[model samples]
Target: MTASPSKLAILTFAYVSLCVQFIFTVGFNHQVHHSNFRPSPTIRLRATTQVRYIQIRPGAQFKIALFADLHFGEAASTEWGPLQDENSIKVMNTVLDDETPDFVIYLGDVITANNIPIANASLYWDQAISPTRNRGIPWASVFGNHDDAPFQWPMEWFSPPGIPEVHCPATSSAHSGEEECSFKGTGRLELIRNEIKHNVLSFSGNGPRDLWPSVSNYVLQISSSHDPRSPVAYLYFLDSGGGTYPEVISSAQVEWFQKKSQEINPNSSVPEVIFWHIPSKAYKKVAPKFLIHKPCVGSINKESVAVQEAETGIMKLLVKRPSVKAIFVGHNHGLDWCCPYKKLWLCFARHTGYGGYGNWSRGARILEITGQPFTFRSWIRMEDGDVHSEVVFS
Candidate 1:
């Protein structure tokens, strides 16, 4: 018996619907696959349900690898720029594989914002930390002068047939959803917010509301491996001002530090280390006069210390606290030495990114801290897997 016209029509509609669904599914998957090749700064990865704690392993030392001045996305429009970024990644991977650090610290200048034409600098920021995140190694970040600098157009772009017109995605009905393809670079707040929201493994914080403009001014406590409840050491990250503001630690920041240090670590009991981008005026006071030898151990010292605009009370406060064993920074690409200053040591991270101006070899500064006797040691791990410039400060 042949089916009625209505039944026949219904059957045809069902068959077409199935075909359409199949096509839609395949197309959606294809789009996703291609997108993985491009930078997805906001993409969320597999994160632990609970916050992971940075701890010293039992009967073992806690090791941290510091990669500074990565300058990711610098000269992104040019050929040489991308190549430099690739080399920077190789350096990070090499050091990570060799040392297998428990934690990674992006000392600063993670992205050269002035060189990036795109409105969102997070694309480069994501790239800088991907190496650590990929390996399931927990990490933290502090911003640098170049991280949120105002966009600077290339001189050549203004030449020739004048500035070329560009188009970006926009709303179909209204201007509600549109892409901003402007020279305005992403600021410190947006960059830090994006990082903390997407990556649970990231221990970075936006600090306090009072400390506006300086978003990265928080403290991280490394718990004792034996006792998770007890903190063995503390790591303080300061937003040594730069980029959109004066390149100096503000007096307000000094006040915040004083209060936070007392609250978290009163009586100067716990061993603490500080990390920031720009060197303070105190660094200049202790810098090697002629040769970087004896008390100071490092490979390169070709340039003078690029001190901050002015000397705030941060250095003086740090000097008073004997618990503050050492402070690390990475603004000067040409210098990487640890000199004794008062009660603590002042060190510069080896230039780890190829995008920055420097012909010297690329490497990261490796720091190891033992919990039992409380010994802090540092050294440089080059891209070629060579290690040198070892120093100990207990």
Candidate 2:
């Protein structure tokens, strides 16, 4: 039977709409069920990949590489041209060869999307950290808010018992009854845990559950393997969920942090470093004077306000703790460093995978920490090789 032109057009539109919905549904479902729930690819690459070396003063201080916000899938191209995975791999390989540090720490936002496909995130992590893992150097990572929610609960397909199951709103609308609504206990959390266990040096975070200790954050401490009594460095990996969307750190996390801080140093000698996805309140005070009160230029809404009140609270906590040295963060996606409070530096690293408005270059920071003082060196990848930014920190 032949249909009229009007009927045909209606059918076509309906078909297109259904197809679009189907794609979105599949993508979303894939993210919830599979994201962070599998083992990364086992690709065997050459061990000779070389990275540029930047010599630090004294030459004896321990080096710690800080890589944040890779945002792998955010790029337009599947294979990020020279600067991304390729350049990153080469640089990491070289760094591992040159500076055999005790271990490495990734500051979060390993995956690009808030709801990334499990395969994409897994593949990205596999490629990104394969070099480090292959070398046997332990690396640790914290969860960025983007690495959480709206995807799946208890993302624990790879590792069991690490994540606990929690009830979240069911994603499937068509399913009937409570059984259809609830997700399998050990799916999403396992994936993230396994990724961290296999790829990271150490792993700690509240998976699938409402951000543990805090709402969505955790703290990590690194010490000298040789001398436990010797003052080493500490990292407070705070989860500033997403952006300034008005969220508060849970009371439990705050209490935990306070207890941990007290235990770290009764006298407080060990230097501490805080890593958060979003810059804290102290960051704005310390933000380059030019960035402060400056309107969000270009397409970004000027009145949105960059810093949030919760940041201030976070800063207050840090300020109270004399051991904290600096707060490292991403999300703003620019090069800006500030020292608002006494003896505290708010450092922002450039994004490695994605670029900001009009800023297309890919870069990251390598931080070196000794007993009391620390240093940071920035690197950018150009056409020939990676270029070192002249700015050095002490």
Candidate 3:
């Protein structure tokens, strides 16, 4: 049947509307930005200039500082209080000053989006890593569930045609929380890539270019300083994906991990470590109790548990890959345990950010990796500079 003029008009209007929306989205994407905050030190560091690969000669050891859940800019206006986020940064700096790690890896949830405006987010986020950048230390990171969550007080949309259709203020309508708002605000993917481009000291990998939608997956090869091609170890940074994304790593991501792990050039299964924001399913097996901070030969302190049930393939792959000896993660702010999950030790970095749910003393996990036998030792470096959760990888 032939459509009436009215029907034709409606269809035309709909098509035009969609086209206009796309244009607006493309145009506005450029406008959204984080505020003026210098993350780079006086001297801008480049990933290429800064040493990414670690070359562990015969008896030498590589020290790694793992800091997790530095949930900056959270609860800016809560009774939970002020300086919570600042305190986390302060703890990070103290650890850097004292230990002087060879490399630092932030295990996600780097920033809490709630109660924050999109523009001011950089101020708090930059502060979280200023210590490492200022020290010119090589650093990398993975994403957590909260990294992309909307700021606590996200910018509200104005009335009329200019009002944003997505990530609009939660109060745009009757929704009690920003969760109901279509607007997701800026996520960790963009924020992280920006740093990689701007800061040379940042070694955080941009996720798989062909297979991924966001920026939380990539391999940071720690090769011998003498020979860039000869890798000493490989660090895989995977996004556990939460908040706006699924809470688990996808099967595709697992396949990608396997592909990348296998493609370590001539070196297959060379010593490696996995850093993600969330723990794998195996973590729950031994993490039932919250143990005190004391590093034993086997495992160390145990905090509350938050396991990733969907990580079966990755865990299985670890068993097959002898090169991967340790898998470090953060999400359970109260937990800092490291136990074997088959072949590799499933470890947690001590929570360093005060913005998260835990009040447990802020701390970071310091790793000492030695070559030859390829064994390693680690301990929790607390905010007060005391050490705990010390253990030698079995």
Candidate 4:
């Protein structure tokens, strides 16, 4: 009953075709299911149209601006919060007008709410980012805990057309059933279909991945477009999420950061800076008892422990990695600076938007770094485009 050779060959071919078809069907189904649950798009910033290359001659200097904790909708009707936004925008535009930097790094919390309307979120993004766009300066950002609150949709929803949408699982309950939340709308997830355009770096997930964990941590590595001889600088933007109140750096981010440290050139003699929403360590030394909350106040011990553990874990990581020289942060509404660890400067810039406790000194920080014994100088903005506090770092 053996089959003929020709018949046997045909039967084998048919079996192989059926297996291929089955595999294709299974893969397609998996992709379809994943998309249905998380439909966010990826958005990337575009390069500045007027990119001017400047060579970093010996004794050359470069400037960068850092601002965070905008909390746009914090006091929607109050003149204080909205006025802060207006003042911040004016100060940023003035900085661009005064001293043009290679680029700017906006530490996150661009929007205040976890569940704010997409239109309102888009308006804030547009208003806050318009200064840079109009100046043709590029900027990068990391998420703040407030930025990742269950209410605010992914930042990519606001990206203009032609950029890919950034996607993440609906891990939080606030945005559970939504297919995708973006800064830009009109229903399509693909960036190519949108008309909005701006340059920024945003990723999926509520916070930074474990590999580079600090807060809502990320790396912004940039080289002088004009100077081939300029030493490259790496800006490690961390995501502290909110404040020490409820820390947000997860265990996953810590593991990711350790691996990432190995990639940095410890011996290259180049300067690296770290930025985060919350300061890694407080500027003033408070008593250990102050760090602990009283149970009589109905405070949960576990919550306090989590904050201490998360902060300590990140500090341990920073101490082990010397390439991280300076850390910039803003959470406290006032300006302060401290040296948390040897060779590591922790600088807390004042909040540009929304004053706290009647501290009406609304301002932004402008940082200038140079090679050959790296240094930095911070400038603060005051009323009517007046900037002061030009403190130099050695």
Candidate 5:
């Protein structure tokens, strides 16, 4: 049909408009479908092969290696700083090689936040756990006072020229990933989050948000090797506050502990052990006056107990709970002892890192647990491969 020029033009315009609409519709739907399938950049998916468990064999003993106050990246700029970190790593490697522990516990102060002088302390934190991770050993950690403490500028660095400009090397153990360094210390939440995200062997957790300023308040159940469903013991890791806040365990944490314990172990049947960085006031009372003699066994007692800022019923609650077998902490480098406090024992790991102020030889506390008739035996494994201060938790 030979139509008029205007009619032909109108028809052509309509046809082109319809084609454009159709293309737009299909493209929009395709984009939406693919977007739905894509995962968020921040979200992580757990691989099926990543699943692991901690269980004690029926006839075998479950051993744990406790490395406290590794304090990696303490003085990154100084000549001796890196040397200290290397020594600390050697200490861990020595202990791990000798004990071949089933699990490892970094009982806080894994990195000295004040000394990190970097935005991401996890870099140093990662180095601290590298030995354990390399060995395919599972581990958990709790926050310590210096883990997220504010950075303190070295007074000596302040000269007449007004704050000498300090520069960090582009590459170092703490900067293994080549991340930009800063004085802003990494917080506890970020540290734990990064650990769990990157390391499949890490059992570390960022506990409830409501327990703000107090992260890492969680419990782990150790199941029997014979029966995976049957739990043998409970391990509680609490964030005794420090760094950004006062070094105290709040009443809320105590309440949380009570509720959580009741919910998990209503009958108080399972034997429980606790791990934290700071010691409580109860430690002061139980500490040996002169020498670490009978009833109390330890290699060193050169310093007084560095108790928490305040005691808000954690000790009281623990003392009343018969299921709590012992509490392990590490803060005071000069003191490493296990003293009885009423129903349970209070113990400390030997000063492990050379970064902190202590000339004491580096070592780690090793705990060996038996399942059938439950028993806990502990001793220190020194950097030089010496073992001493063996104690049985009764």
Candidate 6:
């Protein structure tokens, strides 16, 4: 069937417009921030990869607020009642207003997929990050096991046959009642990567592309002085991977860390604070575990994650790094503690979201780093504005 001349002209114009829009989007993918509003300086890694890194040098002391287990999609009990989503934004702005941290790290489990349909997922994620964006504080993230779980859910007549696939490989191992994973609904990574592209507010990695199809793994150097080359501490955000990859960290990631650590701190010990969603088996070894917030101080009252069958080698590599000082994780909502283990400290962040399954009071783990003598101190910022677990790194 041949189209009329007018129809043909309209089709041609539409095609051209679509092409131009795509070109513009790709061109501006690395340019979410507008000119004249420079935030942090971007630096290249010591490794051969082309990943972008952020150098944070907030003068004498830098405060980092860690929010974990913020499951944003859980619905409220009453129909059309106040959504549990409100809790996440509340915690974010409340903490930001109180502490004014230089950087905020979301320790994963940003959303709960089972309660949220696959299509409206991005809205939850965008809303969840409102506080950071509104305040203009630079932030980063690591995905919890639940972030992308909606993708694994079963598809229930996902789309009309002629609609074409909105999300590629529409289903994951995470099946339950035929609802397929789609960025509009199930793909957590899609929403997060778009945010990461902003660069102005988020330092979420564009890295370890070799690891999995996830955006959460990378090493960011916090410079000591003005020069990005002179780094003081490194922040390693690792993807624990069970949702998209594996529950355990891979040897390749370990090797990448070794390369990056040596590259950044080639000589003296430049400390590093690790952040991830799930904790390793080693976290269980930390002494005096807790089910709630405790007054932990220097090797006391540290909580451990429940034991899980995990692969090895990443922890060994971490221990070998003279610069690596403490590891911070968030998965189990009830446990919040920090303790010394094997010359390094293993810490647990409190569950800071209302949407998750825990009844524990919501709060964030706050880290205050000082550059002068290279000291690290952390405590919990509770929902009621009370701080707990003030521990200086031993």
* Highest lDDT against the true fold, candidate: 1
* lDDT of every predicted structure (CA atoms): 0.77, 0.45, 0.64, 0.46, 0.76, 0.64
Tens digit per residue, CA lDDT, model 5, 1-394: 1222211110001110111111112101111122112111111122232212366644667788899988887877677887898899899888888877778899989988887655667778888887776655667899999998977656555446544344444465443221233344688888999988877567777777777669988887776767654557888889998999789888888898898888777888888899999999999999999888889999799998889999889988998999999999999999889988899999998888888888988899999888777888899999998999999998
lDDT of 5 at 388: 94
TM-score, prediction 4: 0.60
Task: Give the per-residue lDDT digits (tens) of candidate 1, residues 223-331.
Answer: 6767654667888999987889678888888999899888777889889999999999888988998788788889899999998898769999999998999999999
What residue runs in model 1 are displaced by over 4 Å at the alpha carbon? 1-53, 159-162, 170-180
The local distance difference test score of model 5 is 0.76
Roughly what TM-score does model 2 have, to 2 decimal places? Answer: 0.60
Give me the runs in candidate 6 sitting further than 4 Å from their true place. Answer: 1-59, 76-82, 151-185, 287-304
Candidate 6 lDDT tens digits, 175-238: 3222333233356567667666644456686565676644577877676646655656778888
Arrange candidates by lDDT, descending. Answer: 1, 5, 3, 6, 4, 2
lDDT value, residue 379 of candidate 2 = 33
Candidate 4 Cα errors over 4 Å, as ranges: 1-60, 77-84, 114-120, 150-216, 224-230, 243-246, 266-268, 282-309, 338-340, 355-357, 384-388
How many pairs of residues collide in model 1? 0
In candidate 2, stretches whose alpha carbon ends up further than 4 angstroms from where it belongs are 1-59, 75-101, 118-120, 149-188, 203-221, 224-226, 243-251, 289-309, 338-340, 354-358, 372-394
Cα distance off (Å), candidate 2, residue 71: 0.9
Off by over 4 Å in 5: 1-53, 159-161, 164-182
**What lDDT score is found at residue 38 in candidate 2?**
22
Q: Write the per-residue lDDT of candidate 3 for residues 167-283, one digit (tens) a residue.
A: 333355464343443333566657786667656567777666654534678776655434545556667788887766777877878888777666553356468778888787877
Model 1 scores what on Cα lDDT?
0.77
Best by TM-score: 1
Better of 1 and 4 by lDDT: 1
lDDT of 2 at 247: 36
Which residue pairs show collisions in model 5? none
- Candidate 2 lDDT over 311-394, as tens digits, reads 334556777877777676766655533343565656665554442232445445556665434444333322224545323333
